[model samples]
Target: MTVPANVAAALPQYDLGAEIGRGGMGVVYAAVHRPLGRAVAVKRLPGVPASDERMSARFAHEARLLARLDHPHIVPVYDYVQDRGEHLLVMEKLDGGTVWSKFTGSGVTPAWSCAFGLAMLSGLHAAHEAGVLHLDVKPKNLLFTAGGVLKVADFGISQVVSEGATLGTHGGQVLGTPAYLSPEQALGNPLSPAADVYGAATVLYELLSGRLPFDGGGGALAMIQRHVHHQPRPLVEVPEPLARVIMRGIERDPRARYRNAETFAVDLAGAAAGVFGRDWLLRLGAPIHLSPQVAAATTRPTATPPVVRETLDIPVRATLAEAGTTPVRLGAETLVPAARVLAPPAPARWFALAAALAAAAMIAVPLATPGRDLPVHSADLSKPVTLGLGDPTTAHLTLTAAGITLADVPATAPDPADPNPAAAGPTSPLTFELPGASRWIVGGAAVATVTADGKSADYSLQPVTHPLVSIMGAGSAVLLLFALAYLESVLRSVRRRRAGTGAVVVAAPLGFGLGVAVWLLASVLLRHAPDLWPALVCGALGAAAAVCTVVAARRSALR
Candidate 1:
């Protein structure tokens, strides 16, 4: 098919600099929008179609569908026009290539593939919510941006399969790429959101495994037949959880598959997060029922009852493989155990216990002989300690109190430029002074072999508290004020509903008023009482007002 003359002329607005891509339906050009000062993609529809009316209508419908959708992961429709009687769509041009390109080459990592799937699901969910079905969803329609954002593009072949649309199937008019088409779509059954779910799964499978589920040298018809009847090979090469999710998504029966893109997204996310498990159903609070097949798979063989052992107090369920040829013996009767056995204490716990023991030994050994004092040493503080206002950095020092006079406690150099260094230091024979010390205590060394007569104790230093009530109080006040305003708006909405007013008309002003009030209060507080104290006062006032309003509203509702 030749490009339409008018479409060619309209392409200049987009600055169609170079022809970049071509497909069965149209050619995509690298274009620049002069006024917007940004590069864009221009897709020009086929000028002449063998089936003129149907194809043109479909193209126009797709453009309209793209215009209605506004989502981050979807290619934004910038402009659409017919110049010289030819159709063209100007869209956000992505620098990175298509998913197909990546898959056929050095395939993306599993993390990237998962991210791509999520982006596609998010875009598809938005489109589905807006009552549009992307009839053509394949790797070619998914684009990667230079900034690493994934976008779903090519809505030109999308069908408005929402409520109040035409309901007949176009026989022998399969719309999507054959390898990714759902069984229902391949059979020419009426399309629904599940079809998209199936296609998304196929794309995800291809991304992880680097191969399509079905391919044929014969023709499109052969591929469609395989999609309808044949079960694709299990994606065993991919991670188990991901493979399971894809298999479930591409289930032959539409009813057995995810009901919508949102469900698919949730399942895919679970798989990617490594949370996919049989217990997920239990976690979701779903009813537990074993199908006959599962029940049979788990059934244990009947054998002579084993003798009970005294040491084994609990009956342990063992797998068939672990059961071995001999019947395993159980212990004497005991209380039914909890559903889940508690895991053994972790290595961290053992390490913590050892640390505690060491600490206890350090303390107990030195104090066992109270009169014989230990020498303590100070920490090296020559290196600058980095700390925030409320944060503290501590250093340990040890000195022997046995030889040193009680009055000759080790003196610490004052923090330069700070007059209140005494407040930060310790005030005892064993503990020395350090500026900005919240608390200080002398403790024995972790090793106990050293004698207490000259062994020094370690001291831990922390930051002193600097109270600033106004900041915290003010924040609370602002939050309380907003809460009150939100409540007022909600009450107004309920009143309007009760009075038989439409939701939109009543909600608009209430919502606007609430938002404006919040902004105004926030701005006032920020400008005047930037400190904690003033903010605290405001918070108290807001809370009081909110409580009063609630009381008044309750009285009004009662009346």
Candidate 2:
């Protein structure tokens, strides 16, 4: 192919090499500073008319705008020069490809997406302080260095937002990627730094939810119309705190978003810390494996960064579904994402599914004696009764009879969990004694009833827990809770297939205790005919509590 005149032009001071990258407005060449011998990427601004004062002014203005910004997250300009009628900008050469390249194959996660937002906004915040608005803020323009540092790039289409200011060659027109365009910018109205914030938020929503906010698939004009009138999908599908911050950023009215990029960063920092610990941010970027073509385009040798396997320990309450399921590896040569394997179904489930697990253990430990059977005890007269086993479990009654007196018991007498007075201490092979010519059935097929002198009193009973039964019950419950928690995590994963939510680092311990408690309460209240029915009812309640604990945390009540 013939060399274009713009590419052939000589700038004697800098040595330009092969064209490594090309875009609509210019071609990027690997260049070196002649005197300093420093490597840089030189961008040639082509198609400028020699007599166009406005274009000339815009070129010079672009130089000044790029020169003023000084932030680690921004691609810095090294030199600006004009050769013949062509203009060129020498900038820091990034060996790691654009953010766009990373997402084309393996998808981006929410934590890393927020991490990019934090870094990208820092640059935008600096630009706004310098009075410039990055009209185009999309994934294609965001770049990552070889060190995995994400930077906001491509200010060629940006403009200064200062009053009555005309800085670049955009010429007062709609400027930005169509999919991420702000409502005001799409309408050809004046731009603000908030518009950039809107653009950044759109990118975040896409990462977190895994779909374009409004993907009408309509061409350019249709996109502008949609942005002007249509609202994006709800962010509620994602986890809390993080979702709240994103929704505010993409609000249709600029006034509703964080007033400045700095404010938005503050909110973002809190959310990233809440959902994914602050130290885990690096893991988000480490999973991305750039294509060889993208890496070869850079100025240096590329080594695919090691997949960060450093397990992100999300405090049980703070995090949700993890991306541990097999990652969709791009190709054999391309590196796979971090393997986030969850706690495999807990060992508790093997026993939890059957009531006999606990009942059998209870009987086995207490020593079964061919099983004794007794008739149902019932009476129509006032009476008192006492029931006992090898171990003592409190029996609560609605009426005072014999040595049995109503005594108040603490909700957690045995350490904050025993809310039933009826279960004072009744154990295996229970025996019942009735007073005042009344009848009582203890540990029998019949519900214990005491009646005397044409008066009757009945009381609901707490399961007479054995020491072994309590130990085994607790173990079974923990496993049951784990199974429930894992199910919840799976549900969240399916729901957030678009966005990569974190994993269940520590299954909700508090929720587990609550689930066991609910199960106990339910079992006591459900004194059904078949022994299996009561156990099944209580188990269902426990499972519900475990699942709800996770669902309630991920979902917002107000939303």
**Cα lDDT of model 2 by residue, 329-402, tens digit:** 22111122322321223333332343234333322321222211323233322232243222223332232211
* lDDT of candidate 2 at residue 227, scale 0 to 100: 79
Encode model 1's per-residue lDDT on 133-177: one tens digit a residue.
876788889887896577888876566766433322343345577
Listed per model in order, the count of residue pairs whose N, CA or C atoms clash below 3 Å is 24, 21
Worst 10 residues of 1 by lDDT: 442-451
Which residue runs does candidate 1 get wrong by more than 4 Å? 1-5, 163-173, 215-217, 275-559
> Which regions of candidate 2 are displaced past 4 Å?
1-10, 48-51, 164-173, 282-559
Query: Whole-model lDDT for model 2 versus the true structure?
Result: 0.54
Candidate 2 vs. true structure, TM-score: 0.49
